[model samples]
Target chain A: MKVKVRVVPDGRHLEVEAGVKALDLLKLAGMNSESGVVLVNGRPVTEDYRIREGDEVTVVRVLSGG
Target chain B: MAKCSICGGPAVAYIRYQRRYLCDRHFVEYVESKIRRAISRYKMIRQGYRVLVPVSGGKDSATVLTALSKLSREFGFEVVALHIDLGIGDYSVKSKEASIKAANKLGVPLIVVSVKEITGYTIPELARKARRPVCSVCGLVKRYIINLVAVELGADAVALGHNADDLAVYSMKSFITQDLSNISKLGPKTESIKGLAVGRIRPLYEVYEKESYLYALLTETPFLHEECPNVDFSSMENRLKVHINSLEEEKPGVKITMLRNMAKRIRDYPKPQLPISRCRHCGLLSSGDECSFCRLTKRITGQPLGPRAREVVRSLVASLQLAPRQDSAYKS
Candidate 1:
C-alpha cells in the first residue's frame, strides 16, 4: 500500500508506505514528525493517524524562524 | 476520524496536552481563548489603549494580529499593524504583500516602513558593511524600528507573537549558554521605561507554534507560509526547537509547563538592574551613550542613521491623520 505525501511551502512530494502512523510517514519523507502537522485529504489529523492506500497527505511545516 | 470533544463533529486537530479532539471552529476558539487568558493574566492591554503589532507576514504574527483585532472590540482597545520592509529581494516583496493583505482584510491601518528607503541600505548590504551576521543585523534594526514606531504612534504597548515553543526553546538555549539576562526577559510582558522604551506584550505566549499556524489557516488569515531565506536550518536555535518538540511528542504539555515554570523562576530571580539612559543620537532607550542601532549604522555608513530613522517614522505617523489621543481611529 502506497500513499502520496506532499510537504507544504517547499512543495516536495514523496510516496510512502500506507498503514504507518502519520509521524512515521513524516520520518520516511525525511522530516521531523514534531516539526509539522499532517493533513489527510485536507483534514488535520493526529500523529497516530494511520494512512490508507492512495490517501493524499499534506505535511505543513510548523517550526519556523532561525 | 476523531470527533470534536465538544460537538462530536469531524475533528480538525487532536490537542495532545489536553487529550481532546476539536473541530475547526472549536480549535479556533480554543486558540483565541488562550490568547485572551494570556492578555488578561498579564494585563497586557488596558481599556482605551492603543496596541502596535509588528507583523512579519508570517503565521505567528498574522495569527497574533487577527486574534487581537477580534479581541480589540471586547477589550476596548485599538489595534494597528506595522510592517517593516527589510528589502531582502523577492522574499521581502512577498512578505510586504502578505502583510498588506492581512491588514486590509482586518481593516487595520498598516504603517509600512522600508529599511532601504530610510537607511539607504538593505539588510544584506548593511550586514556586509557592518561585518556582522545578517540575522543579528536584522534583529537590531527590527527592535530599533519597532520601538521607534511604537513611541511615535503613542501606542500603549507593542504586542509580539512569541509563542510557547519559542519561549521554551529560548529558555533551554539560554540556560545551556548561561545567558541569564535573556531568561530574565522571557516573561509574557516587559514593562516600559518612561519616555524611553514601550512595553512589550506576547498574546500568543501560551499557544504552541503549530496551533498558531492552524488558527491562521482556519481563520482564513493571510500569511507568508515560507520561511525567510536567511534562516539557517542548521542553527542551534532551530535544532533546539526540533529537540523540544520531540520532547513534547513523548510527553504532552511539557512545553507549556516548562514555559510556565520558567516564567515563575524568572519572577523570583533577581533582575539585573542596568542603568538605562537615553541614546544621545536618537533619544531612545540605550544602555550607553549610543544605541546599538546608531552604533551599527555609524560603523557602516560613517554616520549614525538613528535621527534620520526617527524623522522618517515621525513623518509616517503624522501622515496617518490619527486624532490626537483618540482611540480606535486610523487611516487606511
Candidate 2:
C-alpha cells in the first residue's frame, strides 16, 4: 500500500506506506503540523488523519499576520 | 482516484469554487499564474518600481517575499523587505529570526525595526498605556511603521501578504460593524496618492490561506508558526474567524464568496476620493492635521504636545476624528 505525497512550494514528492499519518508526512518533509496545514484529498484534516493508498497529501503552512 | 482537471496527473487539491482537481505541477502553475493575473488585474506592480514587503516571519509574508523575488528577476522591479520587531519576548525573537532567514533565503535586503527603538514603546508597553485593546494598538503600530518605513526607504509601494481568508474575515468584520468606510478601502491595489502616500498592493489577494502556507513550505521559505503569545482570543475578529472556519468546514468556498460580495459592493459604490494632506508634524500623509500614527504615538507614549502636537490634537478633536472606535470588546 503506497501513497503519493506532494509537499508544495518546495515541490518535493514522496511515496509513503499506507497508514502514514499527516503529521508524520509533514515531519518527514522537515515541516511541523504546528505551523502547517495538512490536507488529504483537498479537505482539511487533523494531523493524525491517516493516508490510504494513492492518497494525495499536501502540507501547507497556517496563516497569520501582524 | 481523482485526476487533475488540467493535466490529468494525480490530484493534490480540489478547488471547490472551480470544481477542479489539481495535481502538484498543475496546482503550482495555477497558483503562480493566479498571482500573476492578480498583479496585472490590479496593476499592482509596474516595471522597475521599488516595492517594500513587510515580513511577519510567517507564511503569508514569506510567500509574498518568495513570489515577488521570483517575479522581480524578470520584471525589473526592486523588492526590499522590512521586518518590525514588536518586542513581544520570545515571539519577537522567533519572528525576527524567521524573517531574517526568509529574506536571506530570497537574497532580498531586509531592514529590521523595533517598536522600542522607533517609538520608545514596545507592543506590550504600548498595550499597557493603550486605552484600546492590544490588538487594535498592534494594528495601528504595524500600519504606522509600514507607512513610516515606506517613506524612509523611498519605496513606491508597500506589498502585503494578506490572503483570501484574511481579506474575507476583514470584510465580515466590517460588515458586522456596518463600517462602510473600511469596506470601501478593501481591494487588491490601493493607488498611491500623488502627494500624500505610497501605494499599497496585495500580491496574494486571490490566494487562499492554506495555499500560502503550502507555498512557503514548498519553497523551503523559513517562517515562524507559533501563535502570538499575546493574542487575545476574546477579540471580535478572532471569534469571528473561529465562526467562519466552522462555516468553511460546513461549506467550502464560503470565504471566497464573501470576498466576492465585498468586491462587488466596492465596485457598485466607489468611495468619494478624500484629499490627502501631509501631517504638519511628521510630513507624512494625513486625513486631518495629524496622521493616525502621530495621534496613536502621542496617546500611547503620553508625549505632551508641543505647539505642533497641540495643533494636531486640536484639529483631531475639532474634526471628531479618532481611530475608528474599537468595538466594546476592545475597551481596555
Over 4 Å off, model 1: A9-11, A18-20, A30-33, A41-43, A48-55, B326-332
Residue B284's lDDT within candidate 1 is 94
lDDT of 2 by residue, B186-291 (tens): 7887776654567788888888877776667667789986778766656776666656665765677787677666665676644747766877677667787877
CAPRI class of candidate 1: medium
Off by over 4 Å in 2: A1-36, A39-49, A52-66, B1-12, B20-23, B245-251, B270-275, B299-332
- Give the alpha carbon lDDT tens digit for every residue of A8-65 in model 1: 8678888878888877877765665457888888777767788998677898888897
RMSD of each: 3.0, 10.1
The superposed Cα distance between candidate 2 and the true structure at residue B272, in angstroms, equals 7.9
Task: Give the per-residue lDDT of model 1 (tens digit) for B1-332.
Answer: 67899999888888888989899999999999999998897788888988999999999999999999999999998898999999898999999999999999999999999999888999999999888899999999999999999888988899998988888888788889987778888899888887788889989889999999899988989999888999987888889998888888889999888877776677765576878898999999899999999999988888899999999999999988876663322211
Error of 2 at B19 (Å): 3.8
- Candidate closest to the true structure, highest TM-score: 1
Per-prediction share of native contacts kept: 0.58, 0.12
TM-scores, all models, native as reference = 0.94, 0.74
Chain B TM-score, candidates in order: 0.96, 0.82
Clash pairs, model 1 backbone: none
Clash count per candidate: 0, 7
